[model samples]
Target chain A: MSTAHTPDRPEDGRDDDPQDRAPEHGHAPGHDQDDRAGYKTDADAGSVDERDEADAPAVDPAAENAEGGEPAARVELPEEQQGEQEIPTFDLTLQIRRYNPEVSDEVHWDEFKLTMYGTDRVLDALHKVKWEIDGSLSFRRSCAHGVCGSDAMRINGQNRLACKVLLKDLDLSKPVTVEPIKGLPCEKDLIVDMEPFFQSYREIMPFLVAGGNEPTMERYQSQEDRARFDDTTKCILCAACTSSCPVFWTDGQYFGPAAIVNAHRFIFDSRDDAGDLRLEILNDKEGVWRCRTTFNCTEACPRGIQVTKAIAEVKNAILSRSM
Target chain B: MSTPLKASISVPRSKDLEVNGVKYNRSSSRRNNFEMYAWLFMRLSGVVLLVLVFVHLWVNLVSPEGGVEAVDFAFVAGKWASPFWQVFDMLLLWLAMLHGTNGLRVIIDDYAERDRTRFWLKVFLFTTSAFVILLGTLVIFTFEPCPAGADPALLASFCAAG
Candidate 1:
C-alpha cells in the first residue's frame, strides 16, 4: 500500500521553490502583451508604459548560486513568464471509502480537502491526497493517462476510470464519493481483487484460435471483417463493466460482461475457426442466458463497447448453432 | 494517545477471495440444449400468453352482457361445452403455468446461493405447477355441465333445458 513519493512538476522550466521564482504579473509573457499593446493608441500610452515597466525582469545572484553554478535563468524570462499564469484552482473534497481488514473489520469513509486545478482529474485529486496528505491512502493507477485501465472505480455512484473523469465534469458542489467497484473483494482502499474477474475472462479463451496451418505471410482480413469485432477489441481488462452488473454481484458463476465482450472479439473474427467452441462455452447454464440485458455493463464500459448488444449477438449465435 | 499498531498482519490474497461463500468455478457445461430450449420457450410462450390471456380476459370480463357479473358457473359450463373453448382454456392453462414455472426456476437458480435450497425450490415449483396443470386439464375436458339425479336447485338452469 506504500506509494513512492514522486512529485509531479510542470514540463516547462519552472522552479518548484516559490522564493527562487519571480513575482507574478497577471498577463502572459512578451507574445501576449505585444498582441494586446497592438490594440492601444496614444490615449493609452501612459498605461502601456506602466505595464512595460512591470514586465521588466530582475535577477538574483543568490538564486543563481543555489541553482548549481548555472547562470541566472530567471533574468531571461519575460517577468510575466517567470510566474506562470495562475491556473484557476478550486478547493475539492473527496470522500473515499477505506477498508483494511488488518486494522479493522469495519470500513470507514475518509475525507480530504485539496486545492485542485480546473483541468485536474479525479486521479489528480487522489494523487494530491496520497502524495501530500497521506501516503497510506492507496489506490491502483498506472499510466496516469486512461490507457492502462488500472484505476477504474466507482466515482459518485458510477463506474469510471479515475484518470478519464475531469473534476470539473463532476458536481464539485458536493463531495465526490470514491468507492471500490461493487461485487469485487476489496483488498484495500480503492483496490478490488481482480482475479475472479480475470478468471472469467480467461475461461472464455480470449485469444483467436484458427485450426488451419499458420499463414506464410500475415493473415490478411478485409476491413469490413475487422470492423465487426473492432468495438470489443478496445477492452483493457478493466473490471468496470463486469463489476457494475447486478447479475454479477449476485451470481458469481456467471461469466461477466467483460469476458463475454472479449469472447465476442475473437468469436466474430473471420480468420478464427474456433467460433463453435466459444459459442458452446457460452451456451452453459450460467452463460448468456443469465444476462438480464440490464445495460449496466454497457453504461459502465469505459471503452464505450455496446456490451448488451454483444451479449445478444452471442445469444443469437448460440441459438443458431444449436437449434 | 494513539494505540500501538500490530507488528504483523495477515492480508488475504486475491485468489483466496470467495464469491457467494464459494470460490468461483464455472458451472460444468451440461452439453445439452435444455437451457437453450427453455430460454426460447420463454420468449415464444411469452408472446402467445399475451394474446391468450388478453382474449380470455375480454371474453370473461368484457364481452359478457353483465361483464364480470354475467360470468357464473352456468356461463363457464356453457363455454366449456364447446370444444373450441375447451382447447383454448387448456392451452392457456398449460402455457401460463409452464412459463411461470420456468421463470421462477431461473429466479431460484439466480438468487439461491445454496444448491440444496435451489433444488428444493424448483422441486416445490414443479410439483405445484404439475398439480395445477393436471387438475386444470381434467376439469377442462371431463367437466360435465349436468349430472344425473343432481338436486334441481343446485343445478344451473341450462342443465334443465337439456
Candidate 2:
C-alpha cells in the first residue's frame, strides 16, 4: 500500500503566485502569514507576543544560578525550551522543485516561505504549503515519524527523510532546498519512480531459507547469532543509501547497498541454508565488488544501518566462498 | 515515468531452486586464494615499497655526493656492484609492478561494463605488465657497467680505475 499524504486544493489561496515574489532573503510576506504560524499584521503583533510569554515559564531558576543571574541567560532558556513541544516559530523558505508532465515541460523551483515551529519537520512545511498556502504542491510521505520510507528526498544536497529532518536542525538563514533523491528518474515534484530500485531489491531475494524438516517449535537461535546480523534488520527499503551512493549512481545494475545489506542479514543468519546461493548471486561482476566504500550510504540511512560495513561483510563472504 | 511500486508483501521464495530432489549450493570453479593473495600483496608490498623507495631516493639523490646531479652511469654502476643494492633494486622492481598491476585490475573491474571488454582490457594489462617485469628483471641482473673493448673515455670511471 502507498500512503501519499497529499492534500486536496483549496480555492482561494491558489491565486497568489509564489513566482511573482522576490527571491530575496526576507520574510515570505503573504503566504507564511496565511499558513500555519498565523503570523499577524502589525496591529495584531502584540497579542501574539503576549501569548508566547504566557506559554513559557517566566523564569528558569537553573539558568539564573548557573550564570550569576544575568538577565540575558534567563531570556535564552525560554527560547531553548521552546523546542520542547512549544515550537518557537521562525521564518523558513522551503525551496521545492516543481514538475508536472501534463503542465510544465521541465522542472522549476518554487519557494514557499512560512513561519514554522522549531519542532516542525520538513514534511510539516510541505503539508502547510499544500494544506493552507498552495494546493498544487505535491510530495509523498507516510508513517510521518520515519517508519515508512516513502518520503526520502534530498534535503540540502543529502538524502534524508522529510519526516525525520527537523527545521531547527537546518540552517534557517538559507532556503531549505528540497528536491527528489538523485540516481532515480524523478516522476514529478519530490517523487521518483521507485520501481527500478525495488527491482534491484527483488533480485537479491531478501528472506530466510532453511533446508530442514519443519520444527515443532521455532528453530532456536543463540543471542550472539541473532546479534550478528541485527544491524541489517532495520532496512526499510528507503533507497536513501542506494541513491546516495556514487557507485550505484554510475552503475544501475550494481546491487546497491540496501540489497547487499538485506542479503547480508540472511547470509550471516545461522538458520539460513541458502546463503551460498545468495553469495554466488552477489559474486557477479555487478555485485559487491562495485562498491567503492564511499560511506555515503552509511551517512544517508535513516534507520542507522551500517551499510558500508554490511557490504564489506558480504564481500568477505564472497571472498571466503570463492577462495 | 511508470507507476510507483506498491509496498512488497509477497512471501520470499528462498527454496525455489532445487537439484535432484534436493537443494544444493551453487557451483563455482574458482576455488583459490588468487584475489586474497593479491590483496595481501598490495598491503604488504605497500609498506615495504614505502621504505625501500624512500631509501633508494635518499641514497641516489639526497644523501649522495651531489643531489640528483650525482645520478650518472658511474653512480648506478657503483651501486649495482654491491649484492645488497642488487637485491634492493630487484625487490623494488617486483613489488612495484605487482602492486600497480593489481590496483589497475581493480579499476578495470569497477568501470568496464561489457564482459568481453573487461576481459580484453585485463588481458592487455597483464600482457604489458609481464613484458615490463621481465624486461626490468633482465636489465637489473644482466646490466653491463663496463665492457672490456669499450673506449676508455666512454666507459665509467670505475672501469678505468680498476
Candidate 3:
C-alpha cells in the first residue's frame, strides 16, 4: 500500500496559475536548496540518517537518475521493480531538508525507512522513525486525526498531512519520500519558518470590526451571514495552502492563500466596518496583488478550504472599493 | 561510553518556555496586552521606517556622482570608520528585520494550527534572523579587506594616494 493521497480538486475557487505573476522584489533564490536561509546542508549525505538500526530501509531521498549530481526524484515503480526488499515489511524511503548555520548550503536531504501496512498513514511511520529509530527526526503534527492542521509536509510531490494520508492510498510499490512544504523557510529536518506566513495573516487583520455604532448587546450576525464566511474560517492556520504556493516560495513577502482567506472572512462579513482600511494594508508592496493563483494551496489544504474562491472574494472587495 | 561527543545543538522546538518539566504558563492579561503592543508597533515602526527609508535613500541616492560614483570599496570603508553610518546601518538592519519578522509573527499566529508547529517554526525564524542580524553587524564594523596584506595594489585609493 502507498501512503500518498492525491488531493481531490472538485473545482473550488483555487487559482490555476501559480506562475502568472512576476515577483516585484526580484528576490531570486537559487533552486539549489542549499542556499536557503543561510543553512549549511550537505549535498552529498542523504538527509535522513536513522539513528536506530531497525527493520527500516535507508529511504531518505530516493536515488537520483544521474542528472548533474542533483538527487533524482524517485519515480513510482511499475509494480515489477518493487517489493524487492526481503525485509519482513515495506521500505518507504524519506528525504527531509537539513540545515546547520556554521556550514555552507543550508539545505540537504536525509533518508529513513519504516516497516508498514499498505494502509498505514505517512504520519504513523514518522512517529515510528522518531521514536524507535531517530529521536532527532522532526516534523510537526498534532490532533493526529487531522483536525488541528499540523503535520503539513510534502509527501512525494504534493503537500499533505502525514496523519491524514494512508500509504495504501498511494502507489506503495515505490519508495515514498517527504519534505517540508515549499515556499517557506526550512528550519531543519522537515520544518520551515512560519513567522513570515503569520505576518501576512495578521496584516489582513482577521477579526471583526463593529462599525462606529456601539450597540448594547453582542453583535448579531445572521446564520446566512455567518455561513458566508464559514468555509473561509475553516482554516486551521496550517500553512499547507500557503507553502504549497510556489509564489510564496520565491518571495517570502507575499500574503499567500491563508492570508487572503482570512481577509475574505472579514471582507464578506456583514459586520466588518473597516473593509477599506484592511484593503489598504493588503495594497502595500507585499499584498494580495502578488498572488499568481497557483492551485497548489487549494490542492494541499487538508481542510478542503476553497482557497482560490476566498482569494477572489478579496480581489472583488478591493475592486469594488477602488471603483 | 560509546556515545559520540558531538556538540549538542539545542533547537528550542517551540520556544514555548518549559520550566521544571512544564510548559510556560501565560496570563490572559499578557496575551490581550500583546495585541495592543503589536498594534502600537505596526504604527510606530511604520512611522519610523518611513523616516529611515527616506533618509537612507537621500544618503545613497540623492548624493554626488549621481550617488553611485561616490560609493566604492573605500567609500564603504570610510563610512564604517565613523560611528554615525555604523549606527545608521545598524538601526536599519535591526528595525527592518524586527519589523518584517514581527509582521511574520502575526501572520503565523493567524495560521499554523498546532502549538508545536508554531513554537518550533518561530524558534527557527527567530534564531535565524537574530543570527543573521548579529553577523551582519559584526561584518559592518569589523570588516577588514586589507588586513596588513602583502598585496598593496588592493589597498584603499586613499592609502595609495597618500
Candidate 4:
C-alpha cells in the first residue's frame, strides 16, 4: 500500500473531496492489489495493506462513519519538506556608514535592527532595511548574486560582496558594520564614483587588438593557450581588488590590480598581436610597477582570481621585453 | 505626495576627483628604462646584501672571541689593514646606501602627493645619500687606525709595537 502513494500529485487542492481517494492514490476504482503491484501481488499484498492502514492518520470514528469512508490520508512529511516548518530567524543589527553630501557635510553611522532568517545574506539584510524599515538607505546592487559584481562593499573593514556574504558566517554577536569600498569618492551612502576605476581600465586597452583582418569565422586557440588566461577572464570589474589595495588608496593614478588583471587576460591570449603596445602602456611609472604585491587584491577578489600573480607576470613581461 | 528633494551638493566624477587635496593626475611614462633597472637593482642588491651583511656581522661580532665585547679599535684596524677588507666594506656601504635610497625614493613617489613635496623630499634623500656614500668611501680608504700623535694607550696594540 506504500507503493499506492505515487510521488506525482496535483499541487492545487482540487482533489480534496473525500470520495476522490481512489484516483488520489494513483489507483482506478475497483483496481485490486493484484492489478496495482503487477509482480508479487499474491504474497505481499496483505502486509502492504496492513502497513498502509497503520500509517494512516488516526481518524475520529464518528466523523469516519458519518462520512461513510476513511478521511483523506494525511501523509506525515519530513521536517524540512513540511510547508509550515519553523525557519530559524534572529534579530540582526546593521551599522551602516551614512554619507550624503546633500543632507550635510558630516558623515554618520546609522543603525538598523531587522529580523532576518539564518539563510539570509548581508544583501538580504540591507534589502530588508531598504524595503521595510527605511527606503532612504541607498546602495548599488544587481543580479543579487555574486556574478554581477555590483554589490561589492566593505564588511567589517574587509572588501566583500554583500550578496555573497551570508549572515550566519559573520560574527553576529556584534553589530555588522557595512561601509563603502575605500580609495574612491563616496557620492552618497555605499555608492562611490566608479569612473576612475573604469578610466584606468580603459588606459590598459582591455580588448583584443589584432592587426590583420578580422577572422571570418572565429580565432582558433589551443586549450593550453586558453587555459593560460582563464583565471583573469573571470573579472567582473568589481573594483574590490583595486579598492582594497594600499597603493591605490594613496595614488589613484596607479593602474590597480583590476586593470592589470584585464590586461593579463589579453596579454597571454596567444592571438592578440598588440602585446608590445600593452606592455609599453603598462610600462608607465603609474602602471604595473606600482603594485606592491600586498596580496590584498588576491584576498578581496570575489571571483578568486590570482591578482598579485598576474601583476607579477606583467612585471616580468615588461622586464623581459625591455631587457 | 511629498516633492523629491533636490541635491544641494554634487561630487565630481572619479576621473576628476581629488584625493588628499591632490588632483588625480597619473605621471606620463618617461619612455626610459630607469625604473625597471632600479627595481632589478633592488632585488639583486637585496640578495647580495644578505650575504655581505651577514658575513660582515659574523666577522666583527659573532665570530670574535668575546662576541660584541671583543670588537675594539685594534680589531677594526686589523680588518681595514687588508685591501680585500677595504674593498668589501666599500661595496657593502655603496650597495646598502643605494638600496635604502631607492626604497625611500619609491616610498616618496608613492606617498608624497604634491609635486613640489615629492621633488624636495627626493632631493633631500639624494643629497643625504650622496653625502653618506662619499663620506663612507673616504673613511674606508683614508682611515688612520694608528695615528702617530695619539695616546699609545688609546691606540691599537699594533701601534705601540710600531
Top-lDDT candidate index: 4
TM-scores, chain A, per candidate: 0.74, 0.75, 0.68, 0.74
Model 1 interface RMSD, one decimal: 17.2
Best candidate (score: DockQ): 1
Candidate number with the higher lDDT (2 or 4) = 4
Which pairs, if any, clash in model 4?
A: none
Off by over 4 Å in 3: A1-91, A100-106, A212-217, B1-162
Candidate 4 lDDT over B19-136, as tens digits, reads: 6463454555455677778889999999999999999999998998999998878788888989999999999999999999999999998898667899999999999999999999
lDDT score for candidate 4 against the true structure:
0.74
RMSD each, Å: 16.2, 13.6, 20.2, 16.9
Expressed as tens digits, the lDDT of each residue in A1-323 for candidate 3 is 11111112112221331211111111111112212112212331122111111212432121121112222223332222122332124566655566644475556776776667433468878888889887877777766655566788888888887776656455556667788887665667777767667766765767666545567777788999988878787677888888887656644545688888888878788877656666665554445655556677767776667788777677666656655
Worst 10 residues of 4 chain A by lDDT: A28-37
Q: After superposition, how far is residue A2 of candidate 4 from its true place, in Å?
A: 32
lDDT of each: 0.73, 0.69, 0.60, 0.74
From the highest TM-score down, the ranking of the candidates is 4, 1, 2, 3
Q: How close is every model to the real structure, measured as TM-score?
A: 0.77, 0.69, 0.48, 0.78
Off by over 4 Å in 1: A1-85, B1-22, B148-158
lDDT of 4 by residue, A1-323 (tens): 11213222222342342222332212221122121122222244355445434534553222332212211222222223234344457776899999998989899999988887644678889998889988988999986656578999999899998876767566777899999999888889999988778878887778776655566778899999999988898888989999999888885778899999999999998988767777877887778877888899988887667899999999999999877
Q: What clash count does candidate 4 reach?
A: 0
The candidate, 3 or 4, that scores higher on lDDT is: 4
